[model samples]
Target: MLKQKSGPSRRKVILIGLDSAPPELLLERFLDKMPTIRRLVKNGISGRMRSCDPPITVPAWMVMMTGMDPGQLGIYGFRNRKGWSYSDYYLTTSTMIKEKPIWEIIAQTAGMKSCLIGVPPSYPVRPIMGNLISCFLTPGLEKEYTYPHELRDEVAEIVGEYEFDAAFRSDNRDEILEAIRRMTNKRFDLANYMIEQKEWSFFMLVEIGLDRLHHTFWKYFDDTHPRFESGNRFEMVLEDYYILLDKRIGELIENCGEDTIIIIASDHGSKAMKGAFCINEWLIREGYLKLAERPEGIVSIEDASVDWDKTKAWGWGGYYSRIFFNVKGREDKGILTKEPGGDLDELVTELKEKITRLVDNRGVPMKNTVFSPDELYKTVRGDPPDLMVYLDDLNWRAAGTIGHGKIYLEENDTGPDDSVHSMDGVFILYDPRERIRKDIGTMSIMDAAPTILRRIGLSIPKEMIGKPV
Candidate 1:
């Protein structure tokens, strides 16, 4: 195991995850839209971040936190079991997490403290050696925030107690954008609290705008449909939001202490899902899947509460490109009856071949590929997917009601927020001493964990399939 790098250079690291920022979007709009990111791209070593299989947000965040693969963390998509809609659980404190995360390892070795703020599914704060502000998955732990309790007056002054809600908006775009601005204001205030009142070794903060914007407004941002009839109606408004977010990044830079080692990242890239490609739908066609019942008619899983033990597989996982395969015994008392045998090696091969057969609306075969449950399994102690699938740049990204899944027109069915696997990767430094590997290739979601641990001088047990970035 590489001991924490012996030097003053690796002090006080701050990782800021831009939930769904993508390279293509940045390239197209950074100079014109986001000056903060443009500054970072020019000054800091940052670029495209690769994502994990199915590339769902929960797993991606988990990967960044653990430096392990989905196989080990067993956080493939959100829920171990489903209720309805196959959209993985919106991870929170209650979600199952199985792995020795970076926070634990850092406390063990670095003697440095950490402050986690608004990170996805990072609930309960775990009583680590640092302070925390829960977000994404964790709700109701608002009391533990840096200032909410310690500096209540200041936190209240900057941002009201409008809790962090990922689906902060309704169908109204203006409402959505305003909500984001408020959230951003709150984030800035929280970061200010850390800089002024706290002394910590490591820190992390998350901005959900990227993910939320992409899911609801990607159609407004892009002109050409890489596949579908997308391109938001209120394109200018969405662009303004991007610019505003960029300014936030710039402000964060200005607000932070000069010595803080700043890092910006996205869990995965984002792209337009031509149409919802119901994975279960394809599975049924392929003979590998069997849905207990047709979801009645088309319904947005989000609005329709699914019977965990009934829904088989769901396609839209989250912004990190994940798909959940609901097997019989593996899930929360799994609902799917057509279960796979434990032979992952053989299963993976079969899955890959079948997934390869899928084509885009233009009738072109999707590339990248799929990993078998065996190939993807990390043996992490928890409820994990029996099999997981992957899609490349040309195909992976998906959303709903705009995405590849069955669209629901009902008010509850197609809400303002949807799902996607963003294309942008987190900006990471393999070793400050070692010039970054220019061609380290796109960073996978699973790679982030091991890499962080390795950076801090810890060992990722061999059982993990992912390694240091």
Candidate 2:
């Protein structure tokens, strides 16, 4: 285990997580506008941190904080399958996270306290050594959103009716922009208050507004987007928001004092969504999945009348595709054999070959990538999909809806979304006392937990796959 040099005083670490922040945006394009972040980069180590495979928000953030892979955590995305039941799925929550996060480990080993806010899967708030505020996943203010129960009242007293997230998918751009600003302002105000009032050895807060903004306004800002309009009304929206975020970050830095080590990170990056790949439609075309009758309009796979007895495989879609096989003795309407040399293996191989060679709407061969659960992680757990697929290097989202009559969609099936998640996110580690001015290049998302533990003078746990950077 790597260790930090022993200092005279106890070290405190503060992490500001900007969801869906990309190196292309934060570290390059808007770096000049973000003075505070730029200053940190000049003084410390900053780089493109490679996010995990199938990088969705929930599992990515959790993976960074726990030094574990999605496989080890048994969390694939925001929603996961409950078991072999075809339509039974569960949204990921704090109750599902079994691994000890960095804050929990510090609280257990060093008796250190942490102040956490808006960490994903942090809903249904559990008791911790210090203060806690739930993430966007929280149902509403009616539910207990803070740890210690009473912290909720204090939070309400400060930022009345705290905004967990914005309705970014709405068609009204102006309303969404205002809502995002309000949510961000309230979150940062609460964060500054916690910095002043809470006793914490570790502090972390994830601002989800950035992610929302990216998904909503990406097409307006990015000229490379297929739908980009040169003089769009919201063209400068992202720049203004980044500047506002920088100002908020400056405030947090001012409140945390010089002794604190500040780290800015993101779970995953954002990029212009090329389009949506109708995964289920493609499956139907390939004869892997069969429906009782084709729907007249677009509908979710779950709602569609599927011919399960004839279906060999089906898929769920989001940033990536989760394909499940109807294997014998596993699924309710099992068809394929599970044996190594059986029909299941043969089908999987065939699907892999065909899916990877699939072409886009323009008849151009797509750069599709596929992975099996067993091959992707150290230990596969939970009701994992038979295959995890990244469509066209993640530029195209996997659309689960069917009855579109075509495979490619210009817009999201669920809602309006301009951007998709990418593999490279930004990471900046700044220690005011030590102006190292070193560029560490690319680091793994899992390295964050061990690195934080090492900096705080704690032994790295054996289970952590990443070494301290």
Candidate 3:
């Protein structure tokens, strides 16, 4: 059983997540542009919320909702290894989560209804107390993406083909901007309709457009960005988008009743991409990773040309690096073991030392650090990486591309990405009827779930590590 708090009327709690929203961007850069968010910060509780380790979208939101670390949730990154296998990898989904999220707990344990709209990792929609609309990763607009199944058709009829996200990769900027506007408008409209029509105690939605804009055009906004140009046409693109977002946010707040509490947060923050640290290329040079043959062109790790027998350690790179050891008895073609002075310990130490000392072309040390899973996570479960690393204070992202012939890559190996996920996201709590604390300095994203429960006069689960704010 869970510890409960006595209350009278059940009020609604609305949580809005702006993906990759940072305090640097929200509080400092665009403060003047977004009046609603600015007012929320000035009158309510605001803080710099630390995101999960690796701090990418997939596991971060799960950590925020479940109050569980990535290891405990059995999810380490967007692409997780399928059990103990060395080569197999799969994208994470809501179904893969081992623990119950806050919405489900509210619905089942407290008998309070919840409507989760556009929350990531919620593909293959499950039955909830009220309604649910799965987020960005949904395969297509044609698929059944909403709960009650028929809800999809209804939303289509009303919003005219719901947009999961903008076409950020396209060359035409106008098309991307138009798509973003259309998507944002439709999502806001749908959320408003649900709020008006649905009977629920908890409502939550996450906007991913901020993340898409940062990834595609961060250079245009940040003057210090390496690719930034003076007086570019897209200079005000991100700021303009935030203003538009603020308008929608104002609308949401205006519609909420006096009993409602609005909590705005982000999964992770964003920053300009300095460069890509090619992990596989570095491993090849250090003799930790072996290839069947020296290739003439760039290749991905999935190319099946790697010699697993001779490999001691290898890593895949994203905003962070996930290092894996071919330990005997743990992998299919295992070679390394945990014995004293063996490849596992010695190589890990050596890699850590070498990576920490890395510097950029401007003679600035990366200021990077490496960690063992045991040192960071409270409980080590699932198929977790052997080591995790951050580069240049997360200014530089990791690239797993091999055969690049250099330790550094000027461009992202995956695609045309200008930014990477930062470790610090933003969190703000506002309630007009109540005298909310203004000095809530700093908190982890994990604290949010328990905080939401506390605000709505519900019990906090024993499994949750977060305490009430």
lDDT of each: 0.57, 0.92, 0.84
Question: Could you give the C-alpha RMSD of every candidate to the true structure, in order shown?
Answer: 6.2, 2.9, 2.9
Candidate 1 vs. true structure, TM-score: 0.74
TM-score of each: 0.74, 0.98, 0.95
Ranking by lDDT: 2, 3, 1
lDDT string, candidate 3, 1-469, tens digits:
8534224655678888899999898877888988888888887888888998879898899899998888778788889877767668989887888798888888777788888888978987878878999989898977779988888877887798888888775467767777787888899998888888877788898998888888888888898888888798988889889999999988987877776888889998899999899988888888888999977788788773889989888888898998888888887788888889987788888889999998885778898989998888888887788899999889888988788888887778887788988888989988777645584767898899898888777788888877777
- Cα lDDT of model 2 by residue, 94-189, tens digit: 998999999899888877889999999898899999999999999899998999899988898999989998987779989999999999999999
**What is the Cα-based lDDT of residue 443 in candidate 1?**
60
Against the true structure, whose TM-score is highest? 2
lDDT score for residue 121 of model 2: 86
Deviation in angstroms for 91 in model 3? 0.9
lDDT of 3 at 461: 89
Candidate 2 lDDT (Cα, whole model)?
Answer: 0.92
When sorted by TM-score, best at the front, the candidate numbers are 2, 3, 1
RMSD of 2: 2.9
